[model samples]
Target: MANASSAATLSICSSSSSSFFSHIPTRVPSQFSFNHQKPKCRLLTIRAAVYTAPSPTPMPAASSSGIVLVDKSDSDKVNRLKSVYLEKIVPILKEEFGYNNIHEVPGIEKIVVNCGMGDAEQNSKGLEATIKDLSLITGQRPVKTRAKKSIASFKLREGTTVGIAVTLRGNVMYSFLDRLINLGFPRTRDFQGVNPNSFDGHGNYSIGMRDQSVFPEIRYEALGKTRGMDVCITTSANTDNEAQRLLALLGMPFKEGAGPTVLLRRKRKKAHHFDSKIKGKK
Candidate 1:
C-alpha cells in the first residue's frame, strides 16, 4: 500500500511539470532574433520630433547671357563719348561725311596704355610703383612685356620683362579717354594739344606722355623717379581723317591751326613772299 501511494505522487508531480513547460513560448518573433543566417536588409522608419510645414523658397533670377546684354541695365549711364556720339557725332557723320549707315560712324575700339620697365629691371620698387600707378589709372592690372631676344648692348636678356601694358575696352576704355581728353591734357605742362598727325593712317592714334605725374594717379612724393608712358587709341574708322574728326568731336582738344596742313600753308606763303622779294630786287 506504501509503494502504490509513492508511485501515484510521482505521476502527479510529472504531469504538473509537463503542463508548465507547455504553457511557455518555444519560438521568438521575427522582430527579435539572435540567429545569423542570410541577414535581412530592412530600412528603419523614424518619425521627426517636431512638426513643420514643407515650404520651398524662391531663388533670384539668373543673369542674361551673351556678349551684348552682359552689362545692360536700367541705371546704365551714357558716358561722355557715348553721349556725344549719339547726340552730335551721328548726325555730323551722316551730313558731313555721307555716312548713311549707323555702323559706318566711327567709334573707339580700345585704348592701350604701356609703360617701359627698363629701370624696373634694376629696382624692384620701380616695377611695384609703376604697376600700382598704372592699376590706379586704368582700373586694371598690367601684363608684363618680355624681351624675346637678348641685347648685349642694352644689357637686356631674353625673357627679361621690360615693360607693362594694359588694354582697355568697353566702358573702362571710354571713361579713360574721357579723363584723358578733359582732365589730363589740360593739366599737361605748356598745355599744347595732341598732334593731329599722330594718327597711324588706319584710325589709330598714339600719344606719348613725358611724365606720369601729369596723371592724378601718380603722387609726386611717392614716386622715386619720373616715368613716361604711351597711349594708343584704336578706332573702327577706315581712315585717319574720320578718326581725327571723331576724336575732335569727342573733345580731344587738338591744337587750333597747328596741324600739318597749317604748316604746309605757312611754308607756301613763305616761299611766295621770298619769290616776291626776289622779283622786287630784279
Candidate 2:
C-alpha cells in the first residue's frame, strides 16, 4: 500500500488522452579530425507530472520558461477575493498551452489575498504570515508572484504554462474602479468584461493591468508599497490566439468593443446629504 500510495501521488496531470515522448539523436559532422569530441545524445521521458498536468511531447529546449497560475481565495465571497493558486488552474494551462516542458512543483511564495480588512500595518502582518503559510504547504521556498494586487494575489512566472492567477475580481474590484473616477483618473465605466484576447483557445488567459495606480494601496507611497502587478497568463496553446478562443467559448467578453461608444456602461450615483447643527455661534 505504501508503494501504491507513492505512485498515485506521482500521477501525471493530463486528461489521460495523451502521454508519449521520443527522441533519436544523430551525430553531426563526426568526420572532422580537429573536432574529436563525440556529440552527446539525450533520451528522456518526463511524463506530464508537474503540479498541473501538461500536454504530452518531447521536453522543450531549456530556453523556454513556464507560467504560474493564481486564484484569489480569501473573501467570504466563496472563492472571490481570496488569493490562491488552485490545483486545477495548472491542468487548464497544460491542456491549452503546448509546453511539454512545463511543471507543477508547488509552493506558496508570495502575497496576501484577502479582499477587505485592517489598514496597512495589519495588512503587512497578514501578508508575512500568508507567505509563510504558502511555504509550509508546498515544501519549498515559494516562487515569486507574477503580479500581486490588493492583498489577495500571488502568482508564478509568465509564458511557461504554470498557473499565475486570475484574481482581478470581486465587488472590490468594482469598488476600486469606482474610486478611480472620484480621483479624477481616466477610465472606461461600466466595464462589461475584460478583453478575451488575454487568453488563448485552449483556456489559458493572462490579466494585464493597464494602470496599477487604480488600486489605492499601490498609489500610496508612504502608507503602502505596491508590488509590480503585470502578468502574462499562459494557457494550453503555444500562443495568445488559442487561449482567447477558449475564453470566448466560456462566455468571456471577446469583442465587446463591438457595442456603440455613445452609451456609457454605468449608472450615475444619486446625491446624498446629512443634517447637523454647527457648533459655532451665529
Candidate 3:
C-alpha cells in the first residue's frame, strides 16, 4: 500500500508541473539577420535572445531667447496708484501728515470677500449657486467654510458648509478693489458713499453690501438667491486714520466729513457742570 501511494504522489506532482509549464509562452529569438547579397538564400538561424532597444525620439526645441514671454504685470489700479503716488499722493501726504519718507504712506495688503449662505443648511443647491455667483464676482474660486461647532438653535452641525470666501492679494486685490470702487459701488441702489467709520482701530476696513446683484457678474433675473457679502480690506497702516487716507487716495469714496476723528467726537456726551450751574441759578 505504501509503494502504491508514493507512485500516485509522484504522478500527481509531474502532472501539476507540466500544467504550470504549459501556461508560459514559448520564447522567440530576439535577433535575426538576412544575407542581402543572396536574395534566393533561405535562413532559419535562431540567435540568442539579446535585446537591442529602439532609439528614443528627440525632444522639441524650446522657444528662442529673442521671443518675449508675457509675464504678470502690476494691475491697472496698482500701476495707476503708483503713478498717482509719485505724482500727487506722496506730496499731499507729506504736506498734510508730515510723512517724510514714501514708505511711511500706508498701503493695502489684502482684501477678503466673505458671503454667508444662510439657506445652505436647508438646501445644499443654494450653496453651490452662491459659490458660482461669488466666483464670477471676484474672478477667483471661493473656499467653502464649515461650522466649527454644532449649534442647536441654528440647526448648524459641525463640518457643515455654511459660507464661501475669497481672499485677494497683491495685483488681484488691487484689480478687484478698482472694480468695486468704479463699477460695483456705482451700481448700488442708494449710491451713497461707504461709511468712513467701518475701519477697525487696527487699520482694517470692512464694507457690507446689501445685495450681491450690485456686481455686474450677477444678473438680476438669473440670481438663484439674494445674498449679502462683507468685504474687508486690510492695510499696512498702524492707525485707522492712515488706512482711511490710503483707501481714499485709491478712490474709495467716503461720506463727507465722516472721518475717524469726526466719528469719535459725534458720540453722546455725559451731562456737564453747565447743567448744575443752570440748576443753581434757577
Best of the candidates, lDDT: 1
Give stretches of model 1 more than 4 Å off: 1-78, 260-282
Candidate 2: worst-modelled 10 consecutive residues by lDDT:
105-114
Stretches off by above 4 angstroms in model 2 are: 1-192, 196-204, 210-223, 226-228, 238-241, 257-282
lDDT of each: 0.77, 0.36, 0.77
C-alpha lDDT (0 to 100) for residue 143 of candidate 3: 96
Q: How would you encode candidate 3's per-residue C-alpha lDDT over 175-227 as one tens digit per residue?
A: 67877987899988877788988877899999999888888888889986578
- lDDT by residue for model 1 (20-66), tens: 99998999888898877997799999987996888873321222310
Better of 2 and 3 by TM-score: 3
Which has the higher TM-score value, candidate number 1 or candidate number 3?
1
Superposed on all Cα atoms, model 1 deviates from the true structure by an RMSD in Å of 14.3
Q: Per-residue error at 119 for model 1, in Å?
A: 2.4
Backbone clashes in each candidate structure, one number apiece?
A: 0, 41, 0
| TM-score against native, each model | 0.63, 0.23, 0.62
lDDT of 2 by residue, 1-282 (tens): 999887776675332323432233344465653745888989898898559678674322221113232223322333321222233333444565554644532211222222221332336564554334323322233342322333334333232222112233344333332233223133333454565444333334444433334444332353233322333333334434444433333223434543212224686544431222233322
Q: Which candidate leads in TM-score? A: 1
